[model samples]
Target: MTMTSPVALTERQCTLIARALAEPRRYQILKEIAGQGGSVACACMQQKHEVTPATLSHHMKELENAGLIEIVREGKFATLVLKRETLDAYLRELASL
Candidate 1:
């Protein structure tokens, strides 16, 4: 059996994603992650945005909790992987509503 990253969803997660997408900056972060082939690190994103580490951390946590981005930690840094399929599914479900 091949192991793959988990992609579970709940009603709350869906709602969280919908709310997260409502913010333009958050949406930009999501798009940036997707554009980077589905993953980017906090440090890299901070460099891209030229924001303070504390501010970046807060935004990252919001994105992480929304399930729009997955965090893969390595030492003191984490790589954020865009959950593209999950995001697209959420959008499709919203459109159907």
Candidate 2:
């Protein structure tokens, strides 16, 4: 069987992603960012989630750490972009099992 994803994810990365997504709010946050298509503003996320700034930051940090998203900072504004390749790799790995 031909089985391989173009992008590869390390076991550690997959574990991290699984753990991060295990959190309901984090999963929702990821979905919202993905739904935006690209470059979602942190301010808009906070407003939509109605969570405290610190709480949002924590969630973003976890996603970033899991390599599920990237955070770009300019001045005081922060933007998030979904790491589709990484997510895709993780999904591929899961499907392999």
Which ranges of candidate 2 are over 4 A from the true structure? 1-5
TM-score against truth, every candidate: 0.82, 0.92
Give one digit per residue, the lDDT tens place, for model 2 in 1-97.
Answer: 9976577888899999999999999999999998999569999998898789999999999999999999999999999999998998899999999
lDDT scores for all predictions?
A: 0.82, 0.93
Per-residue lDDT tens digits for candidate 1, residues 35-75, read: 88998877888888877888777777888888788889999
lDDT value for model 2: 0.93
Best by lDDT: 2
The clash numbers for all candidates, in the given order, read 0, 0
